[model samples]
Target chain A: MKTKLIITTGAALLFAAGVLANAQRDAIVASLASQAGVSSFNADAGRAMFLGNFTGGKEATPSCTSCHTNNPQAQGRTRVGKVIEPMAVSRNPERFTDPEKVEKWFRRNCTSVLGRECTAEEKGNFLAFMISQ
Target chain B: MKKLTTLVSAAALTVASLPALGASPWMVENNTTKSECSDCHMAYAPGFLPERSWLAIMNNLSDHFGEDASLGDAARQEISNYLVAVAPKELRGVSSIAVPLRITDLRWFRGEHGSRLRNRAENNPNIGTMSNCTGCHRGAERGFFDDD
Candidate 1:
């Protein structure tokens, strides 16, 4: 009986943590959507942007694929050869949890690849695609 | 007997006077600096450069190594302060042109590896670049760079 009670409490705590994580992600998504003035996000656009190559940004990193690689689930290497964690939520459960981190990386990487800050719509689409992955 | 004592003292002093082997291990760390710096590459040991180098790098985040790495003033200032505080005392006089804002550019670094490093870092598939300190120095993250 004691063991059963402990298991139930543990399950409840796990569920609570999952809900909190989802809540954080949802809040960021909502803010991005609002900023973009869009009611919905398209995951397909995000995928294209991630894989697309362009000449606008630095020649070293023409697209997200330069560092992140083609597959979101696979580990990638930085220009300096540091290993990057997989972006896919299924492979790495700890991703996209913090809004500040999400915004910060978007600001830095978008500039690296796109040569400018990513639009709110682009940010939302990127998150949507990543979550789907 | 006096000569023997003098010799012993001289030997001890000589050992103490020798230059340190590598950067001092990080005694203090800031979360912002570690996370931000390591996001793109290895969190380089702050003691690997001088205060002037750190200041220059901190000031020019926008064009960091041909990439955009700009940070807000507050975070940038905080990270710069932490790096400056831990910069190597021995390298305090190293000019920026000599080292060129890169730890690997230090004469000590160049002398340590020479031609052997270029082949391994540039050609070896397993170790792609010299900048990946953790590639060979397995204890890079903890500031223990002894194994290489």
Candidate 2:
């Protein structure tokens, strides 16, 4: 009985910690979204960055939607140019969080598509729009 | 004996400095004016971009959307080298942009981009991940929209 109680207590603590962290993240996202003024992603940003829509990643380049769809609950792109899997909030088990990763890809994708850094506000807004989804 | 000792000590110092000297030369040339390419991008996407991405960006400056944001061939190459040379490890601390989910990583991007879509929707090169491809597309650069 004592052991059972201890395990339950431990689980509760872990759960509480998780909740706290999540709450903190949501708050941050909300603030960032509010500041960015991004109502919805519309995946317009992605199309602008993709090679397809731009037809600019060289004549052979592709677009952002070339891989990841309007709904991120899907897969992303690869190095050589191929589909991988789905990663939308519902599809991909644990997604979101990590400014660094977001920054890295935004940087890479923007360059891959746009050929330049996206700007923090743009990133923040993009992020907010994403989380809202 | 004393002279030899000094010589050895000097040699040791040089060896230690080798690591620093061995680094890519661009890191040493990091100047505000040099990275001017970041004027607009500094706020858009700071240290997140890697060298490869930077190189690609600089290379595409000419047709950078419809703005003719072209760079001199040499300058473009230099910027590309610098980005890869100085970029740090990815630090994903939040989930999505708003919340740092218990897990942090652009899984949404990864999940959506399973493979490269090669089909052309009409004349436009139809891609899978539109959001991931804006920065340079004419349609997107002209208007902040990446959805297919």
Candidate 3:
């Protein structure tokens, strides 16, 4: 009975931790949405941007899908042929946990894809889409 | 009997020199360098480039090969110092013409690879680029670049 109780408690803790991590990412997205003067995030718009093609950025990588692939849940490849972890929080729970890393990628990838930094609203929407994925 | 013994000794000598052949792999094992560099690409052996090349690459993280690879100041300095220390002696103090930043751009690398490289790029999906060393050298992470 004691061993069974311990195992159940351990499983519950792991589940709670996963929920907490997700909540933390949602809080960041919500905060960014407010900063962008938006009341809600639009995952559809985010998906469009993720798949959108543009001529503004570098010719080699005109869309996020150029490197990230069309499917957020699937593994992606860098231009240098390096493997990138999947972006979907479901597929890669460790992603979006580090605020600094999250921001740095946003700053770099947004400029690479859009030729400029992403607005907070855009980031929030993007995060929403990834979370949904 | 004497000839057979000599032949065996010669074979042993050749085997001993196997690891010495080709590029010397990374000697430094800094976790910070490995995690940061390998995140985007292979944690390339620092010995591949000269100290000057490492310095140039480290200093220009924001524009690293048209990608943003900027690291925190402390982490960047640590990796730079580690790379500089472990760079091959022959590569150190070399003239600018001899110290091209890209490993593929190095004259010796071109000479060594020659036509085989082009054939691999054209035919081998895993070897889509010369930068993908591990495609052929499966033991690349351990600094082993022996032919597959």
lDDT of 1 at B40: 77
Model 1 / residue B59 / CA error / Å: 0.8
Instruction: Tell how far residue A25 is off in model 3, in angstroms.
Output: 1.0
Give per-residue CA lDDT, model 3, range B1-148, as digits (tens).
Answer: 9999999999989866543333344633778888888887788887888777788899988677776677788999888877766675456345755646798777677777778666867476556677777777788878776665
* Model 1 C-alpha lDDT per residue in residues B1-148, reported as the tens digit of each score: 9999999999888766543333244523677887888887878877777677778889988888878888888899888877765675446447645545887776778887687777877686556877877778788778776775
DockQ of 1: 0.53
- lDDT measured at residue B108 in model 3 versus the true structure, 0 to 100: 72
Candidate 1 residue-wise lDDT, A1-133, digit = tens: 9999999999999889888887888889999999999998999999999999977788889999998999999999888887889998778767888987898789888888888889999998998898899
lDDT by residue (A1-133, candidate 3, tens digit) is 9999999999999999998898878778777977999888999988999999987666677899988899999998887677888999889987787777888888888877787889998998898899889
Which DockQ-derived CAPRI band holds candidate 2? incorrect
Which run of 10 residues does model 1 chain A get worst, by summed lDDT? Answer: A88-97
Docking class of 1: medium
The most accurate candidate by DockQ is: 1
Query: What docking grade does candidate 3 earn?
Result: acceptable
When 1 and 2 are scored with DockQ, the better candidate is 1
Candidate 1: segments with Cα more than 4 A from true spot: A1-8, B1-28, B88-99
* Model 2 lDDT per residue over B41-122, tens place: 2212324443344455566665543333454456556555555555433434322324221111345444544434322312
